[model samples]
Structure formats: C-alpha cells, structure tokens
Target: MTLQLERDAVLRRHIGPVALAAAVINGVVGAGIFTLPAAMARAAGAWAPLSYLVCAIAMSFVVVCFAEAGSRLPTSGGVYGTVAFAFGPAAGFVCGMLTWMASVLACGGIAGALADTVGTVLPGIAAGPGRALVIIVSIGAIAFVNMRGVREAAWMVTAATLVKLVPLLLFVAVGAVMVLSGSVPPPRPITAPHVFGLATAVLLGVFAFSGMETPLAASGEVANGNRTVPRALFGAMGFVLVLYVAIQLVAQSLLGASLGGQAAPLAAAAARIGPVARMLLVVGAALSMLGWIGSDILGAPRILFAFARDGLLPRVLGRAHRRTHAPDAAIVVHAVIAAGLALSGSFTGLVVASTLNTAGLYFLGCGAAWVLHRRRIQTVGEPVDFRLLPVAAAGGMVAMAVLIYVAPPAEILGLVGVLAASIALYGIMRGIGGRARPPVG
Candidate 1:
C-alpha cells in the first residue's frame, strides 16, 4: 500500500494554453528587468545587448531538453520527477532536495531585494518590526492566493507578468523617442575586450535565461501535458530573449558608456529622456520587484511539493489541500524558510549562494536528461518518440558548468555546501524509513 501511494496522484488537467504561456512569461520576465541591466552593463560594457542575444541563443538547447523531457514524463517532480521516474528513488530524492533548496534560497533573495526597494516608495518599510511585518504579510498573501489552485495561480502569475513587462516596454519606447529626436546624446566607441572576457560575460548573460524551464511545473495542471509543455517552453524563451535584447539595444544605444555607471540603469537611461521617464522607470522597478516576488512565491513551492511527494521530505508536505487542490503544506514550509532568510541581513550572500546551488542542480538535471535520452532505445514502442534531447541537454550541462566556474568563490562554496547537505539529508531520510518501506506521496 505504501509503495502504491507514491503512484496514485490524480491528474486534474486544470491549466490550458493560456495558463502555460503566462507561466512561461512569469518565469522568464522577473526582477531582472530592474537588476540585470546594471550587471550586464558592468560585465559586458557597451555590448551588453550583444550579451543578451548570445545568452538567448545559448539557452535554446536547454529549453529544448526541458520541453522534451517534461512532455514525455508529465510528472509533478519536474526535472527531479523525470529523473526519478527514469532512474530510482535515491536519485529522485537528491534531485528534489537540491531543487527545493535552490528555490527557497532564490525566493529569499527576491524578497530581500523587494524589502530594500520598498524602503524607497514607503519609507518606514526598512526598519524595526515594521519590515518583518511587511515581508511576512506580503509572502503570506501570495501563499493564500496560490493555495487556491493552479488555474487561479496561473491567472495571478499572468497578471503580475503583464504588470512587470509594461514598465520595460515603456522604458524601451521612451529611450527610442529620446534617441530619434536630437534630445539624447550620441553613443561613443566602447573598446572591445579579449575573447575570454567576452565569452565569460556571455555565459553569465545566458544564465540570465536560467528559469525558463518553469512552465514544466504546469505539466501536471496543463491540458494535454504532453503537448503544451514544449510549446510553452519555446514561446516563453523567445519572448524573454526579445524583451532583453530590445531593452539593451535602446538603453545602450542611447546612453553608450554612460549606461554602465548608474545606480539604476533603466532610470538613468530614462533621465536622458526627461524627469517623467525617470519616475516611470522607478515605478516600473517597483512593479518588476513585485512581479519577481510573486513569481518566486508561486513557483518555488511547487518544486518542494514535488520533493515531499517523492519521500525525500516529510510526508506531511506531500498531502494536497483537499479543498483548493493546492500543495499547501509545501508552500507553507518554503515560505517560512524564505521569509527567515529575507528578514536576515544576508541578502547578497543568499543570492550568490542560491545562484551557485542552482547551477549545480541545473547540471544534474541536464545530465539526467542526457541519460534518459541515451537510454530511450531501451524503452518499449516507437522509441518513445525521442528527439535529439540528449544533445540539447548536454549543451545545457556544459553551459551551467561554465557559469559555475565564472561565479564568485563564496557562491561556489555555498553551492557546494548545499549539494553536500542535500545528499546527507537524503541518506538520513532513507535510513529512518529503512529498506522495503514504501515511498510517500
């Protein structure tokens, strides 16, 4: 009975094409609208837009792997779920744990970023118990909204996604107007860098497209899970790539060398237009942060739910909310973990550490995809209609490995610790349950 329990989840088919597309958009167009421009400007200089193009091109392979593998498996475990179905319980547990830990860390970073910025618009948000209250309240609201159902959750995500994109679109359009008229100054030559520097910058830029696989999470909820997952993956990746490049082109083209030095790169670009544009960009930044917070609160907990259902985590987390049909327990667990990190003063460290951990997990996912692809011939029936998924997955693995090396040392160590800890936790869980014990779902 216990062994059978893990395989007994009901497939609801609540999400449709719109929901999947919106989730893709939500996953891709995150807080980076405000934060990434500055980082890209610093790392790649005048050719930051070029970095956007390169990164987009590189992520194609990763996107394809995720799409194909997710469609074929159609499991709630996501990357780990696919791996677990393909491999075994032990592999699944580690993959699930690492993915969940990465999600929690990333959510904390997004929340921290929002908290600091909330200080700008609402002055009292940064100090005393006031700040903690705001963080807890904000996250709790998102949690309640998500606890409703995936269909409703997807609607919420879609709305937030549109709100985030509006500001970026305005910034790009406004910058173009400034440049077209004689109002903006002309761009000057930005001396190019060595090949290695350029390549390294491009790798991190590609990493910007990191979470594009998120629509895969909707696989369980999606109508025709086998069909919708791949389509949404491609659509989301293309949309974000276009947005990133367009924003970079308008901003860097108009501001040139000046783009790199500003506290708020988009706002600074807007300043070239006039004070109004600057104000709009600031408001947009706030919206972008809010959108990111919303996306994290919605997406991260799903991965944890996947973990818990696989017997890698406490059984309580695997139980769905009977009324809402949502993964309420996993949502609450991750929210608490992330909220604690957000209230602490280590936002920068968490962001760095999370990115590193994410890189490691990504590599594992890619490798698992590769394994599944190579062994496809062994499966019954028409080869399971396997594609060049292994090749695409291998490319993704290589890309993430390169990014890991380029990341800061502290980040590298933090990720190493996360992986090691996840592995140890898995062993402890297995021992407590003992052999022949059925996996929980």
Candidate 2:
C-alpha cells in the first residue's frame, strides 16, 4: 500500500471535474465537427442529424464501459492500465501502442487542418516551408504549455473549449430563431438512396466520437479521479451529442441542397448571416483544431509514461519534472513524433488509418471491462453490476466490429503492418529483460 501510494504521489493530482470535462470536450470536438456537416449531408441528405443521434446512442454504451473501467483503475494510461490488470503485459502493450499511434496521427491531422484554415485567411501560409513551419510552431506551442504542468494545460484547454464552442452555439441559435419564425424552408423528404446514406453518415458520426476516452488517460493526475473521470466522460459526451445534432440541423436548414458540395458547410451557413459571421466561423475552426492538438498532447504521452512506470520502457520516460510534475520526456517524445508525421503530408490518409485503429483499441477496452467485472476487481468508485458490464462490453465490441468492416483496405493493411512491428518490438524488449511488471493494486 505504501509503495502504491508513493507511486501515485509522483503524478500531481491537480485536475478537477471541470478541467477534466473540458479535456473530454476538447478531445472529442476536433476539426472534424467543423467540416463533417457537408460530408454527412452529401451522404444522408436531410437525415444527417438522425445519424448523429443514432451514433451517439451507440457510443453511450461504450462510454459506460469505459467509465466503469476508468473508475476502477483511476490511473494514467486509461485503457492501458485496464488491459494490463485484466489481461496481461502483452495485451496491455499492444493496446497502449495502438492508442498512442492514433493520438499522434490525430495530432498530425489537426495540425494540417490548422495550417489549411490559416492559409485560407492569409494566403501563402499553406505552401512551401510556410506550412511546415506553422505545423511545427503550433504543435511546439501546445507542447510547451503542457510541459508547464497539468493545471496550466487544463486551463488552456478550458479556455480553448469556450472559444470554439461560442460560434457553434451562435450559429445554432440563429438557425433555431429562423425555424421558429417560419423563415426557413422545410427539409425535403428522404429518398431511397438516403437509407444507405444514413449508414455512411452513422459511420462518420461514430468516427467523430473517437476521442471521448482521452480524459481517462490522465486519471492519475485528476483529483478524485474515480468519480470525476466518469462524470466528466458522460457529461462531455452528452454535451457534444446535443451540440453535434444542433449543428447538423442548422447546416441542413440553411444550406439545404447546397450543403452537399460545400467545403466549409458551417462557415458557409454562417455566411448566410453575413461576412462577419463567416469570419468568426473560420476563426472558430482554427481554435477548434488548436484545442484538439493541445488536448492530444496532454493526453497521449501518459501512455508512454504508464509504460515506463511498469518497466516496459526506460524509467526516464516516466519521470515527472521536479517543480512542474509534468511528464517532460514523454511530452517531448510525442511532440517530435507528431511533428514528423505532420510533415509527411498524408493527413487525410493518417486520419482514416487512425480511425480504424482506434475502433480496435476501443474493442480491446470493452473486453478489458468485461474481464475486470468477471474477476470482481476491487474499485474505489461506485460499483457496477457484473451483468451490466458484459452487456455493455458485447454491444461495444459489435459496434466496433461494424466500424472495422467499413474501414478502407489500405488502412487495414497498414494497421496489420504496424501490429506486426509492435509484436517484433515486444519480442525484442522481452529478450532484453524489459518485460513490464504487473500493476500493484
């Protein structure tokens, strides 16, 4: 018990429920929300909003399982810790590796989005070394903020979340007023092709919900994590679901058929109000992407830190700064890797690959929840029924499996190669006496 407490003390417990909720909100609401309306409209027509609601309902099951697991472990590495306890070191390693990869790729994708948004406002920023510089600087600044400490980083996330959400809410409010006043035209009836379109939109909607698990990654640093983490997760999910559905409704109401071809549907919707609204929407998009980058940098490195803590990697990577209590080395390593990926100019492909990889990882997490429940693992938070755990786990796994089938073949092949490499690396680490020790409860 002393050893466990000593280990826990290494990470400062400064994140409260509000900050944790902010982290969750920031994680799930990335650059995707700014652009997804057009794609969903193109696929599902007037039914796009329904697709978001359906996907949200499906994702709630997974979130419940994650909450139970996270509350049980209340440690850094989120799913990594849960798998390590329920399965073994090998499964845990693979879970952490896949999650870490997805986060890095996500950061790269967001950085590219930020560059593109900036270039739209100020031309010449997207071409040549200018684009690369913007990506690096953006990522580097977020990393520096995170390196300062969790408290500072959490505040930054909260600020960014508020900044990005205002414009979205404003657009929704305007559209709602128009509808209530009978100024907006009614949406067209769904056609035969729209049924298939709903399926596609649901798939895309599920992908947008991918980052909800991020707050749990830093559980060790959260005050009252056992309770706070779960509350934050559910709260953030509910908030995003309402916001997403509202945005979709607004976009469809205003843009109608024109929404299908719009590259920036929300911004275009805002333009219906005027140029100032359009400019504000663009700024919101930039802030939204920046918030995601900040949140990813804050969450992803905890996996490496957890791995190091368990002896899967060098101990130095797990070391927190003396004054700031931040995982300095791990944060630096994540920044370097993400910056390298951003320069590759494969942001869209990387996003697709990471989406598929994340689905598999979430499935593993559901399995871990089931195993933990069956084993009756002692938890510090509210106890969940063993029967409920299995039901949620099964439902989440099935959802993820469906998502996997929808993934592109090229991304699946890439995932396979990455898994193979992880296996080889695991073997090498084991040979060198680097096998991780089991977590102490």
Candidate 3:
C-alpha cells in the first residue's frame, strides 16, 4: 500500500532545460540585486566589481560540485537527496531541513522586501495591515500559480526573469555609453587601504549567487533532468556572473563615491539618465521579487514532498494532485509558513540563521559530490565529469570552512539549535516506527 501510494504520487516531467534555466535565473537573481550596488559600494567603493569576481570564482568551485551531483541524482530532493544518497537518510533529513528552512526564510524576507518596494509607489501598503495584506496577496498569487502546474509556474518564472532583466540591462547599456562619452566618469581605482573592505564585500557577494540549488529540488519534474540540471545551472551561473559585473561597473561609473549612499542604487543610477528610466528600475525591483517568490514556490515544496515520500515527514505532504501531479499540500504548507513569517515580522532571525544554513548545505553538497564520484555512482544523467571533481570538491570544502570560521557567534548558536532540533525530530519519528524507506534505485 505504501509503495503504491509513492508510485501514484510521482510528479510529471514537464520542466525542460530552458524553462529550468529560467527558474534557476529567477532563483539566483532576487531582491538582493536591486540594492546590491549600494551594499557592495559601501564595502569596497569603486572596486566592487573585483569583489564580485572573487566571489564568483569561489562560488564556481561549489557550482562544479553541484553540477555533478545534480546530474547524478536527478530526483525531487535535490541537495538533500544527493547528501542522503552519499551519506544516509538521517544525514539527508538534516540537510533537507537546513535547505528548506533557508529557502523558506528567504521567501519571507523577500516577501517583506516586496511589500516595502510596493510601499514606495503606494505609501499605504508600506506598513501595518497594508504591509501584511500585500504579503498575503503576493504569496497567495504565487501559490495559486504553482498549484496550477509546474509548466505554468515555469512560464511565469521565465516571464518574470525577462521583466526583471530589461531595466537592468537598459541601465547597463546606457551607463556604458555615458562613461564612454564622458557623461559619467570611470570608477576610481582601489587603494591598499581597502583590502579589508574588499574582503567584506566578497563575503557578502558570495551569497548573491545562491538559490541556484532551490530549483533543482524539483528535478523529478524535469524532462531529461540529468542532462537538464547541469546545463541550467552552468548557463544561469554564466549569465548571472556577466550581468552582475556589468551592473556593478555601470553603477560605479555613474554614481562614483555617492553610489554607496542611495537606498536604491540602480534606480538612482537610472535617474541620472531620466525620470522614465528611474521608474522602470523601481518597478523592475518589485517584479523581480515577484519572480523570485514564484520560483521559490515552484521548487521548495518538493523538499517537503520528498521527505514525506521517504517517510521522514507526514505522508500527506507527499501526495500529489491527481490531475496536476503537483504536491498541493506541501505547496500550501510552504506558503503558509512563509506568509506567517512575513506578517509577523519575525523573519529577521531566520534570515540571520540562513547564512549558516547555507554554509551547511555547501559542505554537504561538496561532500556528496566527492563521495558519489568515488563510489562510481551514476543513477541518472551523463557520466560524472571527473575532470575537475577532485579540485572542485576540495576547494568548495575549504571555502565553506572559511565561511564557518568567520561567522558571528550568534549565527553559530542558531545553527547549532537548528541542527539539534532536526536530529531530535528525526529520532522521534524513528522511535514511533515511521515507515522510512531506503533510497530508490
């Protein structure tokens, strides 16, 4: 009966490589990019582009590990499934919880950001019930789209990515011409005194490229997932790297020293071009949030579905809607939790905890890639790309270690609490004779 239920709940394979790449793009580029210019400028001034490059190079190591694992274990659980396959169910459960919590926290944080952005245009929606209402409506819309089907969700994500990119690309193109014409000056060169600032900027910039793995959580619904996953990841990463560098350079060129002061640096840069351009960037900021929320809705619930399917969580969450083949219950639950966090304004702590959660994921992801390759495992997709696997895994692990070593004390304590709680819950489930199943071949 249990096995039958699992088989019946399998998701449909509708997400193609291009759609999946769009989803990955949405996941990687979020509300962060809108204000990233100011933050990076504050940390490293005109040398912000260098910080972005450093972070991208470091993140490339991790991306290589993910490319291999995502190709090999093209399943619903994504990072969790890979870690579990390489380690065990208990470890997988812990890693899954970490990834899910980070993603959910990010959703709530982004929701709050969206409400704030809307508030700029419509002051009434900025705070109190107005804010809460906006959060609810936004999340509800995303949840509704996700429930319709993954294909619909993918289409929505692709559209959102286009909407989000247009304004920024315009900003980059116009700003570049301005610099060439001397309407805007070139960015100032970095000095020796800014080395510490450069480090800080790089540290923060590393996370800007995260959320790629979130979309992979729905690998089970991807058509030709093994081939599709790696292609989407690498393609999205390359596009994002180039786009980020260009945006940073343009912002720095136009704003110069004042770039660090604007709350909406891109909008501020656009304002120099004209009022219409500023409005476009502001609107783009809100739409970008919507796109990210949509992508999160599309992918994160698959973690809950996978957990339940494995008997690590309640079985109800594992059930899929018959017609749509979507994990309807898990989708609702994920949105509800995120909305609750947004409305209560308690996601601040979760946001802080998310940094550590991300570090844990990186470590597990790197370890999984190495162990799986060593075992000659290739459950799906093309054969493991062993050429760079060794160097990439080792570098990824070292990078994660630096992240952990530099984390603040509060974040460390929070991570410890999260991990301990996950372990306790897993034990309780096992003690109650949960029908935990082994990994499916």
lDDT of each: 0.67, 0.78, 0.79
Q: What digit string (tens of lDDT, one per residue) describes model 3 on residues 293-387?
A: 88788878988887787677887999999999999999999999999888775333444456568878888899999987777676544644658
Q: Best to worst by lDDT, what's the order?
A: 3, 2, 1
Q: Residues 1-441, candidate 2: write the lDDT tens digits.
A: 111423456888899888888778767878778877877887788778888888887787789888877766677667777886678878878888888888898788778767766776777876669988999999999999999999999788767777878888898998778766877566454333456666667767876888866667678787776678778888989999999999988887777788877656788788876789889999999888887888788878987887777666777889999999999999999999898888885545567667777877888899998876776664454544445778889999998888767666677787777778767766776767655576534
| Residue-level error in angstroms, candidate 1, position 381 | 11
Query: What is the TM-score ranking, best to worst?
Result: 2, 3, 1
Error of 3 at 437 (Å): 1.7
Worst 10 residues of 2 by lDDT: 1-10
Give the deviation of candidate 1 from the true structure as CA RMSD: 4.5
lDDT of 1: 0.67
The candidate with the higher lDDT, 1 or 3, is: 3
Listed per candidate, the RMSD to the true structure in angstroms reads 4.5, 3.6, 4.3
- Kindly provide the TM-score of model 3 when superposed on the true structure, using C-alpha atoms: 0.85
Q: Which stretches of candidate 1 lie over 4 Å from their true place?
A: 1-9, 14-18, 119-137, 140-158, 187-204, 261-263, 305-310, 315-333, 343-350, 377-387, 435-441
| Overall local distance difference test of candidate 3 | 0.79
User: What's model 1's TM-score?
Assistant: 0.81
- Superposition TM-score, candidate 2 onto the true structure: 0.85
Using TM-score as the measure, which candidate wins? Answer: 2
